[model samples]
Every structure is written in structure tokens, then in C-alpha cells.
Target: MDAFLFQVLAGLATGGIYASLALALVMIYQATHLVNFAQGEMAMFTTYIAWSLINAGMPYWPAFLLTVGFAFVLGVLIERIIIRPVEDAPVLAVVVVFIALLVILNSTAGWIYTYTIKSFPSPFPKEPLFGIRYMSAHEIGAICVTLVVLSLLYAFFRFTPLGLAMRAAAQNAQSSRLVGIRVGWMLALGWGLAAAVGAVAGMMVAPIVYLDPNMMGGILLYAFAAALLGGIDSPMGAVIGGFAVGVLENVLGAFVIGNELKLTVALVLIIGVLLVRPSGIFGKVHVTRV
Candidate 1:
């Protein structure tokens, strides 16, 4: 039972990482109806920025904040310069652009950083909690950060006028334009926000895993599976799905299978979910007007 509890806690910590990235994907999908395949790469680039800052004598907190700000501006700029031009193009175009962006960012990082594995400083203490007997501070901090970010995003989308405009534009671009909303800018903002969120996830996970150009690649797969499991259109679903996937993966890896096949299990679950419920646990069935 203790081992089970420990695995559950461990899963939640890992799931928090997945959930953060999944939330970013959800944000982009909600606004633009297209997944940003470059999300992980963008996050990797921003995390390198944070690493550079820390190496330059900046404290972890300050470096984190600076990286986030840089990530936001970078995201906005990328949207304006690259994505906006192809906004009205076919979905294939957008997908191709994302793939191109991924390659560009990955190559740049490799050239700049030389692909050496580096250790990152943890924002949370490494000590284990007293009395809990098994829970680590790292795990606790991850859970807290995840919940806090999720709450803030929920409030932003629920209460802010800009958020409303973005949602409106996402639902119907033509209708939003008729009402004078800048649909294009809203889409850009969505990408910017998603990028920033992905940056946070990357930074948080970097300390746990070694920092590398491909650090987020595997996590990206887990996140995609979680997002699909939870419902691509539902932010809350993404969070829930991430946790569920995380826990299942951890437990199964510990008991039913080896750690080597954990990702395989996650993929299998994703496929099973798609087959059983195409709309996902929290996804709404879209009714297209013929």
C-alpha cells in the first residue's frame, strides 16, 4: 500500500509536467483549431535561455521570470512574423510551418549549446517531507505549481475580456470579425500564451530531468496522449487526463510492466481511448452545419 501511494504521488508529479504542456496544447487548439507541433521545441529554447541566465550569475527565480518574459515576447513575435501570414492558409500549411519552426529551433539550440547535457537548479528543495515518510518536496512543489497555474489560467479565460474575445474568435472567426474582434491578433495571443505555458513546463521539468535539446521530446508525446485522453478542447480535461495518464503509467511501469515500456503503455492507452470514445472523456461532440 505504501508503495502504491508512493507511485501515485510520483505519477502526479510527472503528470504535473505533462499537464502543463497539455494545457498549452489545449490553449492553441482552442484558439486556432491546429496543434502547435513546435510547442515543445519553443519550450526547450526558452529553457536554454533560463540556463544561460543562471550560468551568468542570475538567481533561479529571477532567471525563471526573465525566461518567461522572453518566452512571451518570443511567442508573440513568432506568431506575428511567421504564423500570421499563413493564418488563412490550409491546415497543412500551418502544420508544415510548425514542423519547420521545430527544426529551426532545435538546430539553433544544438548549435548554440553544443548538445551537452547540463544540470538545472531546482526551484524547490530536495528534502523529503517529514511524517509523510515517502513524499518528496519536489513532488509536493510540482503539484502545487500545477494547481496554481491551472487556477490562474481558468480565471483568465473566465473573467478577462481578451480571453472572451479569443474564445469568440476561436468559435467563429467570421462572427468575431463582424463584431469587431481582431481574430488574427487573438490567434496570435493564443499562441503566445501557449508558448509561455510551455516554457514554464520545460523549466519545471528540466531540473528533474537533465537539460538537453531533446529534453521535451518524450514529454511532448506523453502530453499529447494526455491531452487527447482528457479531450483536446477541454482545459480541465487536459489536467485531469494528464494526472490519470501519469498515475496509470507509473503504476503499470512499477508492477505490470518494466520502465522501458512505460511510453508504449501510454501510447496504447491513447489508442484505446480514441477507439472507445473519439470525443474523449471531456470533449464535446462538434455538430457541423451542413
Candidate 2:
């Protein structure tokens, strides 16, 4: 029982990581109806920036804030300089651009930092949380942080004017523009916000997986699955899906398949869910009355 309980707790901790990244994916999807294939690469680049600051003697929290800020600016620039031009282009063109961006970021990171992995410090203590041994302090703290972020995001979108504007722009650009909202800038702001959130995911997961140029590659896949599972259009669903997938991974990895086959498990879970419910569990099917 103890072992099973520990696995569940561990799953929640890892789930927090997935929830963060999945939230970023959902944010972009909500605004643009498109996925940023390079989201993980962008996160990797920003994490490297944080690493540099930390190495240069900056404290963890300050470096983390700076990295998130840098990521926001970078995201806005990319949207304006690259995405805005192709906003009305074919889907293939946008995908190709994302691919190109991914390649460029990956190559630049390799050239600048090499393929080596670095250790990241966790702000939480090394000991157990609240003196319990079921989970480590860092893991609990990270989960708490993820939940807090999700709550804040919910409040922002529900109670804040800017959030409502962003939602309006995403739902109907022409309508939003007719009502005096800057649709394009709202999209750009969404990109910046997604980037900032991705940076947080990167920073939080770095302490566990260690920091590497490709650290977020597999994580991105899992996040995609989580987003799809939770209803990509719904932020609340995405977070719940993340925790579900994380728990599934841990439990399955330990009980049924070896840890080596966990990725395959996630893939199967995605396929199975999609086959059963094309709209995802929480996703609603839209009907257009012509």
C-alpha cells in the first residue's frame, strides 16, 4: 500500500510538469487555432538563458523571472516578424515556418551550449514536504505552484478585461475588430503569454530531468496528448488531462509495462481516447447551421 501510495504521489508531481506545458499549448490553441510545433524548442532556449544567469551568480528566482520576461519578448517578436506575415497563409506554410523555427532554435542551442545537460537547482528544500516521506519537498512545492498558476489563470480569464479581449479576438477576429479590439495584437499577446508559461514549465521540470537542449521534446509530446485529451479548447480540461496522463504513465510504467515503454503507453492512450471520442472527453462538438 505504501509503495502504491508513493507512486500516486510521484505521479501528481510529474503531472504538474505536464499540466504547465499543456496549459501553454492550450493558451496558444485558444488564440490561434494552431499549434506551435516549436513551443518546446522555444522553452529550451529560454531555459538556457536562465541557466546562464544562474551560472553568472544570479539567484534562482530572479533568473527565472528574467527568463520568463525574455521569453515573452521573444515570443512577441516571432509572432510579429514571422507568424503575422503568414497569418492568412495556408496551414502548410505556417507548419513549415514552425518547423524551420524549431530547427533554428535547436541548432543555435547546440552551437552555443553544446548537447551537454546541466543540473538545475530547485527552490524547495531537498527534504520531504511537511516532514512526510511519501513525496519530496520539491515535488510537492512544484505541484502547489502549478495549481496556483492554474487558479490564477482561471481568474485572469474570467475576471480580467484583457483576458476577455483575448478570448474575443480568438473566437471571432472580425467581430472583435468591429468592437474595437486589436485582434492581431491580441494574438501576439497570446503568443507572448504562452511563451512565458512554457518557460515556467521548462524551469520547473529542469530540476528533475536536468537541463538539456532537447529536454522538452518528449515532454512536448506528452503535453500534446494531455491537451488533446482534456479538450484543447478548454484550459480547465487541459490541466485535468495533464494530471490524468501523468498518473496513468506512472502507474502503468510500474505495474504493466516497463518504464521504457511509457511513451508508447501515452500514444496508445491518446489513440484510444480519440477513437472513442473524437472531440475528446471534455471537448464539445460544434455544429454550424448553414
Candidate 3:
């Protein structure tokens, strides 16, 4: 029971990372029908920026804020300059463009950062939280932070005016445009917001995983599984799915498959979900009239 409790706590901590990224994925998917394949790479790029700031004497919190801001602007620019042109194109075309972006960002980060792994510092102290035997301060702190972020996001989309506009725009751009909503700007805003969220995930996970240009690749896979498991279009589902995947991965990896086959676990879950319920656990199925 003690061992089981420890794994559960550890899973929650690791799941916070997936939840953050999955939230980002849900945000973009909500606004645009296409998924941004470059989302992880974009997060990696901003994390590198944060690292540079910290290395240059900036405080960790300040560096984190600046990196998030930078990521938002970069996301907006990418949407305007790159994605906008392809917005009306076929889905395959947009996906290819996103793939191009993924390759470019990955190569750029590797070139700039030299493909070296570095240690990242946690803002939280390296002690147990409130003397809890099952979890460290960093683990508890990270899980709390992820929950807070998700709550704020829920409030934003549920109560804010801009959030309403964004929702309106996503549901029907033609109708939104006819009603005088700036659909393009709303889409750009979604990208910016998603980028900021991804930046947060990158910062949170870096300390545990170590920092590198390619650190997010495997993490992204888990996040993808979480998003798909919960319902790609639901942020709440994403968070729940993240935690579920995290715990499932921890238990299965430790007891059944071993750590070496953990990636296969994610793959199996994704395939199983798709085969059993393509709309996902919480996703709504829409029927169209011919």
C-alpha cells in the first residue's frame, strides 16, 4: 500500500506535465479543426529562451513569465504569417505545413542549443511537502499549479467576453464573421494562448526530465494520448485524461510492462481508444444532414 501510494503521487506529478500540454492541444483544437504538430517544438523553443534568460542572471519566475509572453507573440506571428495563408486550404495541406513547422523549429533549436542536455532548477524547494512521505514539494507544487491553470482557463472560457467571442468564432466562422466577430484574430488568440500554456508545461517538466532541444518529443506523445483519451476538444477531459494516462502509465509500467515499454503503453491506449470510441471518452458526436 505504501509503494502504491508513492507511485500514485509520482504519477500525479508527472501527469501535471501532460495535463498542461493537453490543455494547450485542446485550446488550439477548439479554435482550429487542425492540430498543430509543431506545438511541442514551439514549447521547446520558448524553454530554451527561458534557459538563456536564467543563464544571463534573470530570476527564474521572471524568466518564466517572459518566456511565456515571448511564446504567445511567436504563436500569433506564426498564425498570421504561416498558418493564415493555409487556413482555407485542405486539412492535409495545413497538416503538412504544421509538419514543416515542426521540422524547422526542431532543427533550429538543435542548431542554437547544440543538442546538449542541461539541468533545470525547480522554483520549489527540494523538500517533502508538509512532511508528506509520498510526495516531494516539487511534485505537490507542480500538481497544484496545473490545477490552478486549468481552473483559470475554465473561468476564462466560461465567463469572459473575449472567451465568448473565441467560442463563437470556433463554432461557426462564417456566422461569427457575419455577426462582425474577427474570426482570424480569435484564431490567432487561441494559438497565442495555447503557446503560452505549452511554455508553462515545458518549464514545469524540464526540471524532472532535464532540458534539451528534443526533451518534449516523448512527452508530446503522452500528451497526445491524454488529449485523445479524454476527448480532443474538451479541456476538462484533457486534464482528466492526463491524470488517467499518468497513473495508468505508472502502474502498468512498474507492474506489467516495465519502464522500457512505457511508450508502447501510450501507443496501445491511443489505438484502443480510437478503435473502441473514436469520439473519445467525453467527445460529442455530431450528425450532419445530407
Candidate 4:
């Protein structure tokens, strides 16, 4: 029972990480109706930035904030410089551009930081708090941070005028533009926010997974499955899906198939969901009018 409880806690921690990244994916999908394949690589790059800042004697919290800011700016720049030109291009062109962006970010990180894996520092103490043995301090801290982020995002979208504008733009760009909303800028801002969220996910998971250029690859896959499972068009659904996938992966790996086939589990889950319910648990099916 103790072992099972520990696995559940650990799975929640991992789920928080996936939830953050899935939120980012859903953000872009909602605004542009496209997935950014480079999202994980972008997160990996920003995490490396945080690592460098920490290595340079900055405190963890400060470095984290700075990296998130940098990621936002980087995301905006990418949208303006690369994505803007292809915004009206065919779907294939947009997909190719995303793939190119992913490759470029991955290679650039490897070239700049090398392919070496580095240990990331956790803000939380190593020892479990309150003498609890089931969950570690880092796991607790990560979950708290994820919840805080979700709350902030909720408030932003629900209360702030800017957030409301962004939401409107995403829902109906043509109508938003007619109503004097700058739809293009809203989309760009959405990209920036998504990048910032992805950065948080990377930093949160880095300690457990270690820091490397390819570290987010498997994570990205899990996040994709989570996004699909939750509903690509729904932010709240994405978060829920992320947690569900995390628990499923951990429990199944510990008791059923062993850890070796964990990635296979994600693959099967994605395929099964697509075949049975392509719109996902919370996703709405789209119907195009002729």
C-alpha cells in the first residue's frame, strides 16, 4: 500500500509537468488551429538558459523568471520572423515550417550547450517535508507550482481585458477584427504565453529527468497524447488529461508492463483515443459547412 501510494504521488508530480506542456500545446492549437512541433525544443532551449543563469551564480527563482521572460520574447520573435510569412500558406507548408523550427532549435541547443546531460537543481529541499515518506519535497513543490500557474491563468483569462481580447480573437478572428481587436497581435501574444508555459514545464521536470537537448522528446510525446486525450481545443481538458496520463503511465509501468514499455503505453493510448473518439473526452467535434 505504501509503495502504491508513493507511485501515485510521483505520478501526480509527473502529471503536473505534462499538464503544463499540454496547456501550451492547447493554447497554440486554440488560437491558430495548428500544433507547434517545436514547442518542446523551445522549452528545452529556455531551460538551458535557466541552467546557464544558475551556473552563473544567480538564484533559482530569479533565473527561472528571467528564462520565462526570454522564452516569451523568443516566441514572439519566431512568430514575427518565421511564422508570419507562412500564416496563409497551405497546411503542408505550415507543418514543414514547424518541423524545420524543431530541428533548428534542437541542433542549436546541442551546438551551444553540447549533448552532455547536466543535473538540475531543485528549489525544494531534498528531504521529505513533515517527515512524510510517501512524497518528496520536490514533488510537493512542483505540484504546488503547477496549481499556482493554473490559477493565475484562470484569473487572467477570466478577469483581465487583455486576456479576454486574446480569447475573443482565438474564437473568431474575423469577428474580433471587425470589432477592432488586433487579431494578429493577439495570436502572437498567445504564442508567447504558450512558450512561457512550456518553459515552466521544462524547468519543473528537469531535476528528475536531467538536463539534455533531447530530454523533452519523450515528454513532448506524452504531452501530445495528453492534449489529444483532454481535447486539443480545451485548456482545462488538457490539464486533466495530462494528470490522467501521468497516473496511468506510472501505475501501469510499476505493476503491469514494466518501465521498459512506458513509451509504448503512451503510443497505444494515443492511437486508441484517436480510433475510438477522435475529438477526445472533452473535445468538441467540428462540422464544416459547405
Candidate 5:
């Protein structure tokens, strides 16, 4: 029982990382109707930036904040300069661009960092909690931070005026523009927010895993599974889906099967969900106007 509890706790910590990135995926999908495959690469880049700051003697917290800010601006610029021109193109084009971005960023990072493994300090302490015997303090801290970030995102989308504008743009870009909302700006803002969220995920997971250009690749797969399982278009779905995927994967790996099949489990879940309900749990099916 203790071992089970420990695995559950550990699952939640890892799930938090997946959830953060999944949230970003949901955000972009909601706003622009396209998935940014480069999202993980962007996060990895910003994480490297944070590492550089840390290596230069800056504190972890400050470096993290600075890296997030930098990511936000970088996102905005990419949207304006690279994505805006092709906003009205076919879905394949956008997807291809994201793929291109992924390749470019990954290559750039590898060249810059020499593809070596490095360690990063966790924002939280290393001690375990009072009652938890197997879970570390870092795992607990990850869960707490994930919850806080999720709450903030919920509030931002629910209460803020800009958030409303972004939502409006997502629902109907043409109508939003008719009502004076700059749909382009809203799209850019969405990308910026997604990048920032991805950066947070990268930072949180950095301590648990080695720092490398490909560090987020596996997490990205988990996030993709979580987002798809929960409903790619729904933010809340992503959050719930992330935790579900994490728990399911860990439990299945530990008891039902071996660890080698974890990725397969996630893939199976994603495929099963898509087959059962193409629209996803929380996604609404819409009929296009002819």
C-alpha cells in the first residue's frame, strides 16, 4: 500500500509536468485551431536560457521568471513574423511550419549546448513531507506549483477582459474582428501564453530529468496523449486528462505490465479515446456553414 501511494504521488508530480504542456496545447488549439508541434522545442530552448542564467550565478527563481518572459516575447514575435502570414492557409501548412520550427530549434539547441546532459536545481526544497515516506519534497512541490498555475490560468481565462477577447477570437475570428477585437493580436497572445506555460513545464521537469534539447520530447508525447484523451479543445479537459494519463500509465507499468510498455499504454489510450469519441470528452462537435 505504501508503495502504491508512493507511485501515485510520483505520478501526480510527473503528471503536473504533462498537464502544464497539455494546457499550452489546449490554449493554442482553442485559439487558432492548430497544434503547435514545436511547443516542446520552444520550452526546451527557454529552459536552456534559464540554465545559462543559472550558470552565470543568477538564482533559480529569477532565472525562471526571466526565461518565461523571454519565451513570451519570442512567442509573440514568431506569431507575428512567421505565423501571421500563413494564418489563413490550410491546416497542413501550419503543421508543417511547426514541424520546421521543431527541427530548427532542436538543431540550434544541440549545436549550442553540445547535446550534453546537465543538472538543474529544483525551485522547491529536497526534503520529503512529514507523512509521506516515499515521496520527495520536490514531487510535492511540483504538484503544488501545478495546481497554482492551473488555477491562475483558469482565472485568467474566466475573469480578465483580454482573456475574454482571446476566447471570442477562438470561437469566431471573423466575428471577433467585426466587433473590433484584433484577432491577430489575440492569436499572438495565445501563442505567447502557451509558450510561457510550456516554459513552466520545462522548468518543473528539468530537476527531475536531465537537461537536454530532447528532454521535452517524451513529456510532449505524454502531454499530447493527455490533451487528446481529455479533449484537445478543452482546457479543463487537458488538466483532468493529464492526471488521468499519468496515474494510468504509472499504475499499469508497475503492476499490470513492465515499464517498457508505458509509452505504448499512452498511445493505446489516445487511440482508444479517439476511436470511441472523435470529438473527445469535452470537445463540442460543430457543423461548418457551407
Candidate 6:
């Protein structure tokens, strides 16, 4: 049972990372009714920025904060410059643009960083935290950080006026505009928040996955599975889905198919969920009158 306990704890830690990215995905979708296919690449780019800052002698925490801020600005700029032009375009056009962004970011990172896999420093110590044998310090720290982020987001959306405005804009832009809210800017702010969240995920996972342009690719897939499993439209559902997917992935990888086929597990989950219940575990089915 000791071995099982350890794996579960480890899975929760990894799940926190997946949950963070899944939350980002859900955030953008909630605001714009579109999935940002470039989210993972965007995260990879910001993570590289963090790496560069650290390499340039900036302290770890300072670099992290700066990178997150940079990511927020980048997201806002992309929304205003690239996405705004196509806000009312066909879904296909938007998808194409998202793909274009993914390719551009990936290529740019490879060009600048040379596709080299670099080591990322962990803010947590190597020893087990609190003298616990079941989990390492980084794992515990990662989970705490994820929870803190979630709590802050909850408070923001539930309490702050700007957060309420953003929610209203997302729910009904026409109504929001009627009520004197800047719907366009709210959407831009949503993008910025999503990018910031994704930056945290990238940094948290980097120490374990190592730093590379393609690092977030597989992680992104798992996050998709988590978001879909939990319901793309529900933030709380995404968090639950993230933890569930994380545990499922680790357990299955350890006992069933082996780590070699772990990515396949995520693919299977995505396909299975789409086939069986497209609405997802926590998603609501909407009906429109013809």
C-alpha cells in the first residue's frame, strides 16, 4: 500500500500541473467561445522567457513574476492585433489562425532557443516536504501553488467588479455593451489571464519535464483531456477533471499499458469522451431553436 500511496500523491502533484493548463483552456473558451490551439505553444514561449531571465542572473521568483507579466501582455496584444480582426469570422478561419499562431510560436522558439533541452531549476528543495515519505517537496509545493491560484481566481470572479464585468461580457457581450462595459477589452483581459495561468503551469512542470520548445505538447494533450472530461465550460469541472486525468494517467501508465503508451492513454480518453459523451462529465448540452 505504501507504493500505491506514493503514486497517488505523485499523480496529484502532476495533476495540479495539468489542471493549471486546463484552467487556462477553459478561461479562453469561456470568454470567446473558441479554443485557443496555440495555448500550449504560448505557454512554452513564456516559459522560455522565464528560462532566459533566470539564465541572465535574475532570481527565480523575480523571473517567474516577470515572465507571467510578459505573458499577460503578449496575450492581450495577440487578442487585439490577431484575434480581434476575425472576431466575427467563421469558425474555420479562427481555427486556422490559432493553428498559425501555434506554428509561429513553435518555430520562433526553436529559432531563438535552438531546440535545445535545458535544465530548469526547481524552487522547492530536493527533500521530502514536512518529513513526509509519500511526496517530494516540489510535488507538495506544486499542489499548494495550484490550489492558491485556483482560490485567487475564484475570489476574483466572485468578488471583484472587473471580474464581474468580465464574466458578464463573456456571458452576453451585447448586453454587456448595453450596460456600458467594454466587451472587447474584457475579452482581451480574459486572454491575458489565461496566458498568465498557462505560464504558471509551464514553470511548475518545467523542472520535471525539462525546458524545450516542444515540452508542453504532450502536457497540452493531457490538459485537453482533463478539460473535456471535466466539461470545457465549467472552471470547477476543469479542475476536477485535471486531477482525475492526472491520477488516471499515472495509475494506468504505471500498471496497465506502461509509460511508453501514456500519451496513447490521453488520446484514448479524448476519443472515448467525444464518442461517448461530447458534453463531458460536467458540461451542459445547449439547444437552439431552428
Pick the winner on TM-score between candidates 3 and 4: 4
**What are the C-alpha RMSDs, in order, of all predicted structures?**
1.5, 1.4, 1.1, 0.9, 1.3, 0.9
| Clash pairs detected, candidate 5 | none
**Candidate 5 off by > 4 Å:** 288-290
- For all predicted structures, in order, the TM-scores are 0.95, 0.96, 0.97, 0.98, 0.96, 0.98
Which pairs of residues collide in candidate 4? none
Clashes of 3: 0
- Please give, for residues 81-103, the per-residue lDDT of candidate 3 as tens digits: 99999988999999999999999
lDDT of each: 0.88, 0.88, 0.89, 0.94, 0.88, 0.93
| Worst window of 10 by summed lDDT in candidate 3 | 278-287
Query: What TM-score would candidate 1 get against the native?
Result: 0.95
Task: For candidate 6, write residues 101-205 as lDDT tens digits.
Answer: 999999999999998799999899999877898888988999998999999999999999999999999999999999999999999999999999999999999
Per-residue C-alpha lDDT of model 5 across residues 87-180, encoded as one tens digit per residue: 8899888889989999999999999997989998887766667867777888888878889889998899899999899999999988999999
State which candidate, 1 or 5, has the greater TM-score: 5
Poorly placed runs, candidate 2 (over 4 Å): 288-290
- The candidate with the higher TM-score, 4 or 5, is 4
Model 3: clashing residue pairs?
none
Candidate 4 lDDT trough over 10 residues, lowest sum: 1-10
| Clashing residue pairs, backbone N/CA/C < 3 A, model 1 | none
Q: Write the per-residue lDDT of candidate 4 for residues 1-290, one digit (tens) a residue.
A: 88788788899999999999999999999999999999999999999999999999999999999999999999888988899999999999999999999999999999999999999999999899999888889998999999998899889999999999999999999999999999999999999999999999999999999999999989999999999999889999999999999988999999899999999989998999898888889999988899
lDDT by residue for model 1 (60-105), tens:
8889888988988898899899988897899888889999999999
Worst 10 residues of 1 by lDDT: 126-135
- Minimum summed lDDT over a 10-residue window in model 5 is located at 124-133
- lDDT score of residue 108 within candidate 3: 93
